[model samples]
Target: MGQVREGTTWLSVIWRVCNVFMSLFFALATYVQINDPDAGMWMVGYGVPSVLCALISWKPLVSEHLAWRRVADLHVMISSSVVIMLGWRIHKEQITQIFQQEEGREFFGLLLTSMWLLLCRHSGRSAVGKLRVFTAVAITLFPFITWFYYHVNKELRSEWPSHCKTAI
Candidate 1:
């Protein structure tokens, strides 16, 4: 529904600040990655869109209009997927030392930022706001769970099996 129409609120301001901060950080990261001679065009492909989306997200908050908010939501959603794919690619590239790698941080950054934006966007409804908050809290725990699982199943994860294995 359109109940969560764009209107400047504390939540919107917070989300806007978050988006601006993330955009700055991602922009800096992209710059650093681009400077690396070994870094290929793929980083640019992901980085450009990510930074653009992050930057644009602020427009809705600044404009404080329903249409702009919707636009920002759409862009954030797109950027979230892009960053997820980018993060996965980085994680895969570090398969040799996944345990030692911090490659998935970007995905977490994107995900958390997106969650906050979504939460703020829906803050008009108490039920939806609570749900978003709950979802954010739950998702925040995933990294720790993943780390624990990785440590416990390190051996299994190290070897990518090609055949189906019985799970009895």
Candidate 2:
């Protein structure tokens, strides 16, 4: 029983740390959208998750609030819809390197936000599982690594819209 408690405590710490990282990533995502034509829409898309994740990191129990769940759910629904549309667009365009194009990037941003929100749902009520911690680490790392890859390899972003080139 004591061992289980210790493990849960450790995993909860990891969950909080990962949420902090993800919040920052989403916040950065929101900032970079300043140059986008549809900046406001994209900003809200990323901003909500940024704030929610921040709340979770600050107080894990925030996830248990009805208001928080409703807001997160609404965002998830909207993000999922956008993800489907973006997926179709990517498919139609035959976009193999999704990070290179604007819509491709948008697709990923929304998808990540949606996924993380779903993962966080009801997480405050119990100890975060090992799988959730591992997933949180991956989710926290992916965007930053992908962004760095694009930032370093300018050639990969050669075909990107002018606005997309300015932020990173």
Candidate 3:
């Protein structure tokens, strides 16, 4: 019983660490959007999650609050809608290399945000599951890895719009 409890505590710590990383990632995402043509929309989109994740990191049970849940739900709804629209556009246009296009990248960004919110939705009410911890680690690593890839392969971004190129 003591061993099981210790494991659970470790999982909780890992989960919070994941949230901390994600909060930083979202903040950086928000920062880079400042150069976007529609900076306000994207800034708010990324900014909300950054704040939400930071709250979770600081207080894991913050998600249980009515206001927090409401804000998260609303953001997820808006992001999901945009994701659907972007998916349709991508399908209709038959975009081959999604990472090569701005809309495609936006699609993935919103999808990531929505998925993370959903993962965190009921977290305050239960022990951090092992599966959730594993998933969080994977999700947390994805954006960083992809960003590094783009940073290293500068040629891939040669055709990016002027605004996209300006991001750090």
Candidate 4:
């Protein structure tokens, strides 16, 4: 039998952790929704990407070349920055709130796309310029797309805190 490569083993551990985090986020969202209707919707909104990430992680074929760690790092950085900015905008927002914003969700989605592009690039599996363009577009438009979706969806209004009324 072929042994698992060392890199693959480490990658598996990292992916597992990411999956666990996503799962926990999903559970928390469900719990919040059960306990408080208003907050529950916000949790549900955030949980969508978390669930997506978890599902993606489950597929070794999907996670292997995608460099999930690098994508996750970028997501954490970008999302954290947006969260901090939002917190600053609304004095009442807590540091932890940055982790729970829609911006964070979008970051993960964009990160996934970018990582896929990188995979294609490394594998020489597609036209070179295409992946670059896709990565650039995904990174550039992620925040706007997320904000647009959040604002246009009237149902998500309840997810916003009264004090943090302004868009981040």
lDDT, residue 129, candidate 4: 41
lDDT of candidate 1 over 9-127, digit per residue (tens): 44455444544554554454455454444445435434643454364454543334576467557756775786778677876676554334334434554565565455445344333
Cα lDDT of model 2 by residue, 37-145, tens digit:
9999999999999999999999999999999999999999999999999999999989898777778888988999999999999999887899999998988888888
Root-mean-square deviation of every model:
11.1, 1.1, 0.7, 13.5
Alpha-carbon deviation at 138 in model 3, angstroms:
0.7
Give the number of the best model, judged by TM-score: 3
Question: Candidate 4 — which pairs collide?
Answer: 33-40
Ranking by lDDT: 3, 2, 1, 4
**Candidate 4 positional error at 144, Å:** 30
Instruction: Estimate, for each residue in 1-168, the C-alpha lDDT of model 4 and write its tens digit.
Output: 234465445545554444455455444434544433355445544454455456554653443445655554554555456555544554454335442464444345434433433332232232224334444345435444655686687666566544333423
Q: How far out, in Å, is residue 100 in model 1?
A: 4.1
Q: Tens-digit lDDT track for model 3 on 1-168?
A: 999999999999999999999999999999999889899999999999999999999999999999999999999999999999999999999998898999899999999999999999979898998999999999999999999999999999988898998877
Q: Which of the numbered candidates is closest to the native, going by highest lDDT?
A: 3
Q: Which stretches of candidate 4 lie over 4 Å from their true place?
A: 1-4, 60-85, 91-168
Give the Cα error of residue 96 in candidate 4, in Å.
12
What lDDT is obtained when candidate 4 is compared to the true structure? 0.46
Comparing 1 and 4 on lDDT, the stronger one: 1
Sorting all predicted structures by TM-score, with the top scorer first, yields: 3, 2, 1, 4
